[model samples]
Target: MRTVGVEEELLLVDAESGRPLSVAARTLQYAAEAAEPAEDAGDASIAASGEFAPDEVPGGSIEHELQQQQIETDTVPHTDMAALGEGVRAWRDQAITAARRAGARVIASGTSPLPVEAAIVGKPRYLQMVEHFGLTTTEQLTGACHVHVSVESDDEGVGVIDRIRGWLPVLLALSANSPFWQGEDTKYASFRSQAIMRWPTAGPTERFDTAESYHSLVSAMIASGVIFDKGMIYFDARLSHHYPTVEIRVADVCADAADTVLIAALCRGLVDTAAAEWRAGEEPLALSVAMLRVMSWQAGRFGIEGNLIDPQTLAARPAREIVADLVDHIRPALRENGDEELVERQIAQILERGNGAMRQRTMLEKTGQLSDVVADLATATAGLEG
Candidate 1:
């Protein structure tokens, strides 16, 4: 039992337009209540008056982000799987209530439904990002499911990330949610994946042997003026500076919280398995980054419709087969973590209907409308809440 945390970046959506709302007024409104702002706070998004569970107690300290259309919710560090679930649920439920009060809905999509004008968070740091990344990072209106798992040290974080490279696609396949973009079928499971990957440094990562080596590389990036800070080294997997954890940043925003929990559980299992193996003097098997990219691209392009490259053998395998195999592979860790049943149930769901991307695509295609997509995503979100 150690610290694991989640950072769910949610989209601020407009009720009427069904598009992203560039309303930091409301974003900050909810943030203020979550954090309990200055004396001028009685105007909008008051905290729901009640006693939060011990798991949700720390979520009261909310902060703003660099995008006007987004809010970042950090779940309290959890020592147990159940505690993590409770904390994530509490933060999301509180977010939903606050959004309702503001007459806006907190939508969970990687990209907005409509083409929105790019706007920063109205903060100086964000302005610096715009200036630094130019169009690549500035125009990114996307979201991700970032998971942080406990690690021994900075070196352990990178160690986990190194071993985690092969498993990143399995996680991405589970969390795919971006099926439609700008109100059209983009023919990709997670179009947001490609959009977000446009940044200078974001994709399936390579193994960095030690924390010192990782820091040296990042330091070089900073010293060369390629990135503004350590924060801008946005790889698919890396050591989290904010916490002592290996942060995996590949998965898209899962439409269902069950999928979110599934991804988190799987993530937890993967890191634990690798760390344990490493402690036994096992070096992580290295896979080709080129093949990894292709596998990820296939996942994004076809979602559950096509096969993915098995990173180990570099063979194309059906997505369904991959899921069953991955679930079986992580069985030991799942049991050790006391999440066997939860992981199995989640696996059954993926087998039954496919991931969120598949379901959302079917929903949209049947109705021949974009509204159906939005409604389906919201419905999935609501079901997760329940």
Candidate 2:
């Protein structure tokens, strides 16, 4: 079995006001202290031990994001969903405790509902991004859930990515959690997707059946001077540069831990299904980047409320039907991985209770206040805080 891991970027908000707070640095200091066994152990202990301070965590698991308003947690890769879920929940609670100490709270929101005054992290690379990308880098306050599933080889990884590009939008729709931006309802389920697409290289990618072709395109992009390096490839899904895995980066940071796990299970299933198809000499679908872009836009706009472009025919279909088709297509892989029941249960729950976007809108409608939206977000995140 290919072990899978997840990385979630979360927003730090005021505990009372639900407004975003720029306290990531302070919260991180607290987290580092909490991670250490002794209070006075300090940087030396962290440096000398050279490992995550506790067993349930992993080194480099928690870190600062581009903005001081955001913090990120990464899980140690695992084959069992139970262990992965527990690890993620542990880190989330650690973040919540760390933030609470700083008079802030961590919320798993795709974007802040109130006005965003992004505080860019002071680093050379970030500064370069600010200079190179201008407002696109400065105004970014979006959070995403990235799932990394191990692959045996780069060729297999590229093949999986090539075969799975069309299905990426469905994942995006399932994880749509950002409905409000700048204190107003953007009316789109995932405004964050639209916000992040400002990047020149961010979106669905064309086919790259071989590792050489993928690397060649990445080199070409870098050589063009349009982007700084391979990190900026920003494809919706791509081979991880630092890990022997395929990284799926299309979904928003889910509000619930269960939703995050569900996304991970589905991504692993997608990769496994793709790899099996490749091994059987099945050719990848010839979907155009233009059409895929359209599908992504629709997913972001409607989220599961309206129609979606079915990947098989590129024709519009009910979002539920499309999702059902996806579930059926990946059923064998899910069953093989022993995640079919869990994934189906979570999907049904999502359908019944609604995704983060729908839930946010419901809160806003009931209270007619954005603060209520933030408060509800805090409550939702609190379920996994322990």
Candidate 3:
């Protein structure tokens, strides 16, 4: 089985007011301190107060993000779905604890519900981004859930990316979490997707026939000076620069750990299915980039509430039907990995209870307040509510 990992970016907000807070630096400091050895009495006391011990959680990490209003957590790669789920929850707890110590609360929201003037983290690369991109950098405070699945080689990774392009929009629709942005309802299931698409190189890419072609395209893009580096090659799915894996960057940061795990499981299933197809000498779907972009837009607009473009027919269909097809398409892979039952249950739950976007909208409709939406999201993020 291919090992899978997840990286979730969470929004930090004022606990009482439910407004975005710029305390990521302080929260990271607290996390670093908690990870230190408890050599002194005071340190032991702090440890007793529920701060996470570094050794207790292996291969997971909490880190700062480009924006100061959010933090990102990376789960250790795992072949077992249960272990991957536990890693996600543990990291979320670590982030929540650190945010509390910093006088903030962490919520798994793709965009802030309240109005916010995002502060860019004062890193050299980030500073350069702001200088070059101006408003695109200044206004980009969105969060996403990036999943990495291990691949045998770069050729296999590129093959997976190519074969999985059409199905990527379905994942986006399933994990759409951003409904409101800057205190007003954006009326889109995932406004974060819209926000992210503002970047020149931040959407779906054309299929590369081989790994060399993929690398050559990336190198040419970098040499053109349009982007800063290979890191900016923000395709919906691509080969990871540092890892022997394919990174899928389509989904929003889901508020529930179960939802994140489901996405990761489905991603791994897609990679497995794609690799098998490649091995069997199957041809990838020759969808054009323009069509793929339209599919993505539809997913980001309606989520699971309305319709999505069917990758097979290129026709709009009910979201539930499309999602069902996705499950069927990847059923063999899921079953082989011992995740079929869990994925089916989670998909049913998401469809019935609603995804993060629907839940956010439902809260606002029930409470008539966006603050309540944020509060609900915070509770969901902390795993304190069902």
Over 1-386, each residue of candidate 3 has an lDDT whose tens digit, in order, gives: 89988889999999999998999989888887776454532211223222345345323667778899988888767899898888788778878888999999999988998899969999999999999999999999998999999999999999999999999999999999999988889989999999999898888988897999999999999998989898898889989887788999999999999999999999999999999999898999989999999999999999999999999899999999999999999999999999999999999999999999999999999999888999999999889973
Clashing pairs in 3: none
TM-score of 2: 0.94
Q: Each candidate's root-mean-square deviation in Å?
A: 4.5, 3.7, 4.2
Q: Give lDDT: candidate 3, residue 325.
A: 98
Q: Residue-wise lDDT of candidate 1 within 52-167, one digit each (tens)?
A: 34233433333455677776666656657676776666666666666666766776677765567777877687787788778875778887888878888886777777787877
Per-model TM values vs. the true structure: 0.90, 0.94, 0.94
Per-candidate Cα lDDT values, in order, are: 0.72, 0.87, 0.89
How accurate locally is residue 382 in candidate 1, as Cα lDDT from 0 to 100?
A: 57
- Give one digit per residue, the lDDT tens place, for model 2 in 175-275: 99999999999989999999999999999999887999999999999999989887887899989887889999999998899999999999999999999
Model 1 CA lDDT for position 66: 65
Q: Model 1: how far is 358 from its true place, Å?
A: 1.8
Of 1 and 3, the candidate ranking higher by TM-score: 3
